[model samples]
Target: MTRLDTLSARGRDFLGSTHAIMAGAMTWVSERNLVSAISNAGGFGVIACGAMPPHILDAEIAATKALTDRPFGVNLITLHPAMADLIAICGKHDVSHVVLAGGLPSGAAIEAIKATGAKLMCFAPTAALAKKLVRSGVDAIVIEGSEAGGHIGPVSTSVLAQEILPVIRDVPVFVAGGIGRGAAIAAYLEMGASGVQLGTRFAAATESVAHANFKRAFVRASARDALASVQLDPRLPVIPVRALKNAGSEAFAAKQREIANLVDAGTIGLAEGQLQIEHYWAGALRRAVVDGDIESGSLMAGQSVGMVTSVMQVAEIIDELVGEAEAALSNRAA
Candidate 1:
């Protein structure tokens, strides 16, 4: 039997999940309600603290604790101005698993998190950074590829996961990006990932806080729908983020042209200067996720969005995925 026939015993202990799947933390989407549901369903759920205030973050953590005794994590955006406060909150709550996104946490912050005995997980784009994080004492590293939604990394998960796994034996590796089904999960495990992390799939789950329109968009999406938002000029301030290609993206591109013209004419005021992130793009996603308006809102989804057909309960989805992964392994053994 191959290594895939037996789920990695080491992988299960750190993941704290019966299913070798993790719900990727998403801003607005990964609230206490949704996070608890996934954790309770036998997968890891990470509460996203991206846009939340310190008080709100604390309350959410408390709320999640009340809902489930299962192990769950909190995602802290390392680039946020209040990152120090966020890390402090995690330590105060005894949140043992913290997923650091955006950029590497400061050495001081990393040390503080380590002091709390929490497992530090960060997104690494290059093998060098992955090694550095492990050396810095991170417990696990998530290699995010360009195919993922929200902010993505430069390398594909396929390439990065393969490169990092053989080099790093001390830490667990979780592959993120383009993972949304049992087959994908099985493939990653076969490729040597400790586990798989999924965001787009959970975003379309029944208990997701995303707007109905947002889930519908994911359901209707095809594999080709995921692409980085193309900028008309190289000087645009906002970084490229992957999203379902739709009318909202087109509108944002058009607005970008207006911003460019204003800059050329020297008529752009400091207050009026447009930030692509401040435009309806991010907030538009809020419209879709919170209100379910597909046409006017931006849809944050992964390439696997095409595979999501209908929204189901978190437990049912987790069970189905686990069953399929196990069956695939069993068949492979034969």
Candidate 2:
């Protein structure tokens, strides 16, 4: 049998795809074109419904459906003010899979998604949470680490996989973070992961609508160049966002320091100060992705950005990944 045949059946069954690979949802990037392309290429594609209102999400889902009949998923930020409404929108579209990201989901949100008969997938930051999510009736869990782009956890992908994969058997766990090639996917599958998710590697796909400058930054970057945002003050509730280092990252640091100084001087309330810090990154990703302003906008990417050398069609990228994974698995068997 071929190595691709060795992939976990649970994953293939759950995703209803030819392979257990998923193109991680990237804000402003995973739109109709790219999502449909990935699905048509035999992998699962997820739409990143980041902070979009119900109407916009509805259109995006419909647009993607028009492009491909293959299965795809929608990723929703759990803390979005319109979480409930978004869940309803997914149901309206009969979305087959829903991935709740950003944070732990509220019971009402979870129940709402379950009511739609769509499989629920949530990010598991730890082994305990993985078990807890399974008990809460989530159909699957995605264990993503700090090496991933955008907001991230504190642990590394390798460590999180070791800690969670062995303990969770009730639901298939898809590992994400720092995965750039199929060899890494094969390793995780061998370690019992049902599948793998990749974001940075796909962000530069030809199908992605990200501006040429944004994709260029990713192509020129090395793993070391992808750094996580730092919180200058613990009192501030700024979540760390991983991105490529640039003038924008440095400017964010300066903005945080200014906010902290204001709070220390009693010039601004603590809550207001935190909000100011948080708002600094607002629209920054779109600035980079849409406007091609890599200097002053967030170049959100993972350490795997180094591995992305050029923009190819989504199908070509998937073919390369599957081929590499097969070679690795075959070599191991030989």
Candidate 3:
């Protein structure tokens, strides 16, 4: 039997009822409505709590519960100042899964959540960190490659998963980055991943909260659009973020230079626009996602954006992905 057919016994056990294909925890976009849709559709949905306040996150969690009885997750960015409060809220709501994005969570935070019996999911960039998180008590680890959207590690999923999966025997490993279809999912499963997580494909889903123009951008995006910018000097002070190459990104690159010049001159305060790339929000992204302004907004998409051609409902998206994995496995046998 092929690896896809005989997935890791431990990996399968971790996924339980909801199959692979986890929806990423996108800030501002992963509200209750979107999170509920993915979970109700049989894939795991994560409420992006990275940006919301604790009270707001609690309400969002309640809202998600109102929408579906199936298990879902909450995404907590490890670097945020409010991490403790968010963990408290997750436990209060009995949120079963907490995905620690951006970086690993603090040891105290991890212990607190574990005490609540919540499954912890974290991103590990290297084999060392992967084993470290396993020892740190993470229930599962998402190996995010340089191909993933938003902030990413230097390593690719192919390299990280291959090196880490072999050493970590207890926790399930989910591969993220450049995954948009069933063929990729099947390949990862064959590689011993418990499941695959998708971000860009869902950003274009019918129920996605991203701007319509943003969605179109993702649908039209290519691998070339997903290049990671070089941070020549760490002292320059800019957070490295993975975004599609567009006027916004290019403009932001220039803006960074200007901001640096101003900071050196002591002319303007650096309190706001810390990540000027995000300010491109005022550009086309708002018009595209919220106003359906498909031409103007900066669409945040993965390299897999090119793989998507049409807008599909949540259920259709899940069905098509699963079908693709099945077909690839079947053909491998033939």
Which one is best on lDDT?
2
Off by over 4 Å in 3: 1-12, 237-239, 267-288, 291-297
TM-score per candidate, chains pooled? 0.92, 0.97, 0.90
Candidate 2 weakest ten by summed lDDT? 1-10
lDDT of each: 0.81, 0.91, 0.76
lDDT of 3 by residue, 122-208 (tens): 988888888888888889988888778776677787888789878876878889998887988888888778888888788788888
Best-to-worst TM-score order: 2, 1, 3
Candidate 1 residue runs with Cα over 4 Å from true position: 1-5, 267-280
What range of 10 consecutive residues in model 1 has the weakest lDDT sum? 269-278
State the local distance difference test value for candidate 2.
0.91
**Tens digit of per-residue lDDT, candidate 1, span 1-334:** 3344365545667877666678899877999889999999888999988778798999999999999899899998786778788888898989979998877778987898888879889888888988899888889988888888877766787888788877877888888898777777787787778888889889988898887778877888897997787667555556567888878778778877888788778887433544534555668867777877777677777787887888888998888877777777778868
Worst 10 residues of 3 by lDDT: 273-282
CA error at residue 261 for candidate 1, angstroms: 2.9
Model 2 TM-score on a 0 to 1 scale: 0.97
